[model samples]
Target: MEKLDVLVLLDVSGLEDKEKFEKHLKKEGFHTVPDEAFVYTAESSTTTFSTKAYILEVFKKGLQKNTFLDANLIFLLNETPYPAYYYDKNSNDFELSESKEAI
Candidate 1:
């Protein structure tokens, strides 16, 4: 379904990890936008799942780009190519997680 605006893409439904991420972002004084976005993603043509894509931008950058980044955190999952956690301050770069376990 069409993403509920670009800001709502960060909504992680009811996942506890998502909640913790949200709280952590807020604790860091970062402003997060809710982006409950879903894309009909397909892998190998036959495998597909309506997965969620989330992004966060610092308040300053969000104002310039009209998008926000998840300040000090990113929504993580095990299926992706990199570790499930990371810290990305630069809006245009992807920084992978350093620890194997969530700290």
Candidate 2:
């Protein structure tokens, strides 16, 4: 299994209750990063795909609860950052688009 560091950056400015959003992320096994970011460690055979799936699931749940408005999710594999997905307000879901070079 490959271990990767997953980071979820959420813009909760539009959320009616920011605490509810934070609680939801914590309940889903994400750790707070002092600011609004959430972090997690994911082990998977296909780190890229697994990270994308995880982000999609989070986006789905957030959309259902109207807690997540916009967000960007990324995973670091061997310290190389890769974007998994991003929430688009127009689509109301995660969109996989061209991402910047892995850092």
lDDT string for model 1 (1-103, tens) is 2322211222222332444444444553434543432211221211113122223233223323333434223332223432333435464544445765432
Superposed model 1: Cα runs more than 4 Å off:
1-40, 45-66, 71-82, 85-87
lDDT of 1 at 93: 42
Models 1 onward score TM values of 0.26, 0.61
Q: How far out, in Å, is residue 57 in model 2?
A: 1.5
lDDT, candidate 2, 1-103, per-residue tens: 6566565554334556656655666676666676434444433345567656775686457555755445665555556665556567787766765665322
What lDDT does model 1 reach? 0.33
**Count of backbone clashes, every candidate in sequence:** 13, 0
